[model samples]
Target chain A: MSGNNDYTQIDNLLREDRMPHIWCPGCGLGSVLHSFLTALNKSEVPLDKVSVVSGIGCTGRTAGYVKLDSFHTTHGRAIPFATGLKLANPELKVIVFSGDGDIGSIGGNHLIHAARRNMDLTVICVNNFIYGMTGGQVAPTTPLNARTSTSPYGCFDRPFNLPKLVTAAGATYVARWTAMHVRRLEKAIVEALLKPGFSFVEVIAPCPTQYGRKNRQSTGLAQMDYYKENSIIKHGADTKDVDIDLNGQIVIGKFVDIECPTFYDLQTEILGKTFPHMSKTQAEEASA
Target chain B: MSRDGQLVGEFFMNGDVASAEGAICAGCRFFAGYPITPATEVAERMAERLPEVGGTFIQMEDEIASMAAILGGSWGGVKSMTSTSGPGFSLMMENLGLGAMTETPCVVVNIQRAGPSTGLPTLTQQGDMMQARWGSHGLYGTIAIAPSSPQEMFELTITAFNLSEKYRTPVLIMSDESVGHMSEKVVIPPMEQIEIFPRRKPTVPVDEYLPFKADADLVPPMGNAGEGYRFHVTGLTHDERGYPDMTAEAQDKLVRRLLDKIELNKDDIIILEEDGIDGAEVVVCSYGISARVALLAVKAAREEGIKVGILRLVTVWPFPDQKIKEIAKKIRAFVVPELNAGQVVLEVERCAGGAAETILVPHMGGAVHDPDVILEAIRKGSK
Candidate 1:
């Protein structure tokens, strides 16, 4: 809390000294981080037992700012790192806070595999639609025909419908929200934090310096206005219908929430059946 | 058997299986690996044996995930390891840098095959020696041990784990296909006879702990993920508090300590075995499978009445520069033999510093060196 500005309520969870964060003036990463911290505060889980993991990007800096046992891992590898963390210490509540490019492109294999295994983790992905830190390159979530540093002629490639992708990949909980929907996003995060298996919440946020200015939404407020106009909250909507396009209707809601035995639960059950004398506690003690 | 049911007896096993057994004996309770040639047996063995020992074995999506997983497992307060070959090792380089920067303790085994890019999947090569040293993009020191046999693979994997724990850095066991697949008798000692080095834990309360604050030994005590010590770690240039400090000064302080932690302790970390070096005219310098071949050449040179000796490098990185320098001053010439075209020999030539003639016996590397080729180099070196 020893800093120039005094925001006492949120200061306990933030590394204020690392402030003057690297996000752009009109960027929405700050809002997403704030919502995450608030949701973390509201959850009953012990802060000391919670570990935050992030990959490389503007959003990845979230791990550095959080005052927890956080890991700022390699680009696209946060899910795997968090997977290891959760598997090694089942008592720990592991959360991955990264960006769409990191979780969808190079790290897509791990993302799908983790979901397929139904790993017990909460993943918060900020989809800015462009690679912000790398100067607005086309990202996997970049809408078709969106102008980018690499795609000056307007990108023609198909962007992934992440909600549909994760839902198909077997994520037990899936949701999407814009940064404009603060309360709703916070609530989604809280629910994801409480869920038992492979919970994913995608926050569609503004990258004013990157995706925004190029797409004519030059300010965060303008992007918020866009969300206010175009976003539709359809809870229980079919995940297949959640595709986003430029100036098109953006579907946002809690699309999936069901349950299955998590990776650990299944692993422990199989091991216990195999080794009759082996209980979870006995296994942990043996490891110790 | 130990509490983990690790067998305690001598048995014939390949280097990969022995490596897994060695890790289990060293108290490594977490393994994350992918299936790759000459190294997949390590993963297969772990998959079969880890469950019996109450350890966890996860076959990750790829080498990148495997490497990242072990780092995560290490932070969760377990000894963790991974095994891979050329392509997988290439995939692991980025996260290996992450492990070094974060100072996470883990072991990485590279059962190398000939490769510029998957050249020969089932053949032997010692080409990765340089990659093991400088593959990751950064200024950092590395610890890599080269094992010549199944016995050495078992013995040195345990050593790799111990060094990794003591230094809080990722240690590499660089075994080539020849050693990795070769079968030999390995003695698994009783649990009481083996040594295990656990990570140094913080003595202070959670409030007083700084995650990256180094002790006098330049290694910080680590805390587990869920032990109520909510500390932060990142791959960025960070301060001792483990918070990102994007400054030249912070980079200088942190990078220097990361390098110095291993570099300054080179004497304690480097392992070299020497024989018949008292006033020898020529010394055959080599490691891994090539070291065994070079030893046969040295013995052949002795039979031919030439004054030649052998200097085998067990710990290949930290590069035995001082030892080579000292030997270069006394020897007439050095014959360096390796499966690669010429990797570690370059180190010998550089460390020799023009004090002695250095000859490289290069093999294209589908197989071990012809002993007579090294013997011929020894004869020329003696001349």
Candidate 2:
């Protein structure tokens, strides 16, 4: 970087006025967002045609910090909101950026449904393995035997295998990466953006304040070192084998990539049969 | 008129179906809802009809999703709506607050069923009156219209959209099971005759625009996603620039604006129908099916020389405080007949300010109030 005072390179894509974001120091959201913006720049989509929608969380704040037309919506509602945005104006590129607790726990219903419908959109879930915004509660993705504010003894319930869940629900593209793998994450994001159907990317991030402190890695730097030591990049690995274990290896790579007709494509195909009264102009409108 | 799939002639239809036609004629192009009893027909009609007009329809996983989707659709620059009953309306409360805080314009229809929980599903009652006003929580005000007939359902739905667009808030069409299921003749007016209120757009250039900045009307001009104005909106309390402001001072400004927009323009937004209220000693204050039921009681009481009048509330929110207070001065009593156990009567009693005796004639659920019970209340109230 040329000067500390300058942010001209990324300023076009960021709402710098809303800077000094609320994320704690050592949090990996900044780098995750960096990867996203880099991928956004490389994708060549027009800025005006893009919209970012986020549910309630620390990561949901990404919608506000981004310069694009964005919506910081209610808790656990980002997926359905993005679905509506895409269906209403089929031409706009709707992106859902939120957290594991928001999307995987409370929003789990909407996430699976969107995947099942094969809606065309991209979702980035930053997973820190705890509910960071609400002071580190046990999350749907918290590993068994991990300790949280709510699970002081240990989490007894099994956490979600996000890749297995979404892939089974019919997502066309799925990938996972850690904050340590910025280049790979950026490249995966670009590919997902170009994918035609539901594309999801889970970025295992460092929450120095919450999950890291409970586990051995108390600092964000320690969490990054843990990722460096534990993560294994295995592209095209089966999703069923990607469950995160408390003391085991972290499997990180692109998991599922396939093809299918999107929700809009199928909806447009059955227009005349379902909506028999469609006019000539309306046909083109729905087909958009 | 025919180009947009607007039905331009009269047709016999149920109130639920009439509501769907009204949405189409009012330029609503997107509908998101889940099927529920008493309100399912509205979604069924929209599924078949919205696609005909180039509108989009999606039955979400639940009412919560449905409510969130329509708010999303609204920011996408399309007028959107949803229909549900008591159970679904309860699920939609949180996102309804989201719509209020963000100032997203949309319509919600609740065909009331009786209950504190799921009292009577297939039956009719004028319940959910107070819930429509305060169900979503917070200190914001909402606009709700009561339709007593299928024709009024058609007309008031159009009014709902107009007020929503004009005020930039969620407008509720608080009809109940009886009117929603009852069939009647509804006129589909020509497109030109229908007054359409398009969403107000900010006239400023993109660089110069602040998303939540209010124009002279206190309601800000909204810009859609792809309109080149990169604006951000949130359910969190925000300043005029649409950035989240956690301070109470900022919140004070935001909440006051959300409420004051409707308060300052109450006269333009409220609609009331009154007959013989001027010289009457007793005025029946009612809405929705209760209003229609009161008609019979009012006539019967008038026949007995009680000088009773019917004050039908078309737009029920902002409480019509001034009008009720004014009318209370001339009338000896304001008798309220409702299917719920005294909801809207509370508002009447508060607005009456003890100038007139406000008597509540309540029926629990499953049926309308008998005309005689209301007549008895009228007689008791008149004394």
Candidate 3:
């Protein structure tokens, strides 16, 4: 995809005043944001036909920065809000941008449910392991024994394999990529957007200030080094495959890719067959 | 519109059933709720009826999901609602704020039941009166209507939808178990006389519609998820451009307008009915089932040649300050009879000033207040 488009006419859709964003220097959130905008810029998705929704966290701030239809909703409820937006108007490309703490913890239930229903939404979760915005609290996806401000003695809870969870929960498309894999991340987003069901992409982002400081990887460069060295492509890793110690970890690729009936499709099928006039677009398009 | 067309007349149904029918008549295509006592009938009725109307009905995992799904359904461009009581209402407070901040229009029915923590699930209580107004954190305006009977439940439930769309804000239909579970008759209105309000749609082409643009009416036009008018919405304070603005000036401007939409439009929003107050020395003010009890008290007092009146509040949130202030001057005493200890009475005191002496006819929970309890207060006030 070409990097250039009508985006330059706006001189970066980001709020220059809100910049340098609250994300720590060298944090991958900026890159993720860039890649997302580029994806939107490259794809046929109209700027006016997209709604970006986010929950509370550093990554959740993506909605604030993105110059599009965005909703910076309450913590853990962005998925529900996005679901509402999607159901309200299925034609709009509803994407959920949230942090691990917001999605895997407070919003975990919504995440799984939206997936189970095969709701047509693309969820881009920035997994920084710990809750960065709230001063590094131990989150649901925090690795066992990983230290955080809240977990002074290190976290005891096991981390969630987000892609795996969604895959099992019935997401049609599931993929994961680290901050270092910008191209892959962009590709995953493009693929997710093109798919008809719940598409989930868990980006392992670096929170150098909070999650990193406590875990002895305080610098963004250091965190990037960890991703570059530690991640391995298992080719066909299962959602049930657990990562431990990072001692010989093989990071998964596209874990789940299958065709399932999506909420939009089901709605079109049921409502179209029943209330022919109510399916305005479908009837018109069909007749046309 | 002929009055007879709208007059289905009253029949025997519980408050919850009345609310459900009202929702259906209001063009609600989606119903998402969990089964809790008192409010269960609303869900049951919705489940049976929504499917028949070719609408969607889902029993969510919990109250939180129920609230979430309805909010989602509304954005999906369908009118949606949910019902709950005490503990369930408490669970909904967080997402309720989300609905408020996002300016999503949906209906929430809270059938009052006793509680500090699940005090009485099956029995009736008006304890949640205050919680309905200020339960959610942060500053925002809410619309809550109280219904005195199954007839009012049917009527107000529709009114709640109208207000929700007109204001682009969530509206609550407050009822107690007594009204919710009791069997009574209600009339569904016909097309013309029964007013309906739909959310304002963008007319200035999709791209030009700023989702948060404060219009002449103060409500920004709402373009649902699929309408192709992509606009941003956020819980954080945002400018008219729909982008987050965190400055104090921005917060002040945004929050002020959030309150001002209802505040400045009080005449259009506030609903109160005054009875026999022309020369009354004392007045009885009540709402919901208690209002019915207070009416009987006023009638009995009038029979004994006591000058008394009744002010029944239908819209409780804007608080009818002007009406209360005006009535306070002529009436020497004001008696508030409520199913709860004393919730709305405080607002009455605020609005009444010192023009009239205030009295509280408090009922803890369970049974309804007797007319004599309120009548005695009226008799004492007259003496």
lDDT against the true structure, each candidate: 0.91, 0.91, 0.81
- Estimate candidate 3's alpha-carbon lDDT, on a 0 to 1 scale: 0.81
| Worst 10-residue lDDT window, candidate 1 chain A | A1-10
lDDT of 3 by residue, B64-94 (tens): 8788778877877899899999999999998
Candidate 2 lDDT over B199-317, as tens digits, reads 99889888999989987878998898888898899989899989999999999999999999999999999999999998999999999898898889898999999998889898889
lDDT accuracy of residue B105 in candidate 2: 93
Locate the minimum summed-lDDT window of 10 residues in model 2 chain B: B1-10
- Candidate 2: which stretches are off by over 4 Å? A1-8, A272-288
- Locate the minimum summed-lDDT window of 10 residues in model 1 chain B: B1-10
How far residue B133's Cα lies from its native spot in candidate 1, in Å, is 0.6
Query: What fraction of native interface contacts does model 1 preserve?
Result: 0.81
Docking class of 2: medium
lDDT of 1 by residue, B1-383 (tens): 65668889999999999999999899888999999998999999999888898789999999999999999999998899999999999999999999999999999999999988988999988888899999999988899999999999998999999999899999999999999999999999998898888789999988898989999989999988988777888999998899888899999999999999998899999999999887999999999999898877888889999988789999999888889999999999999999988999999999999999999999987899999999999999999
Question: How does chain B score by TM in each prediction?
Answer: 0.99, 0.99, 0.96
Estimate TM-scores for all models: 0.96, 0.97, 0.91
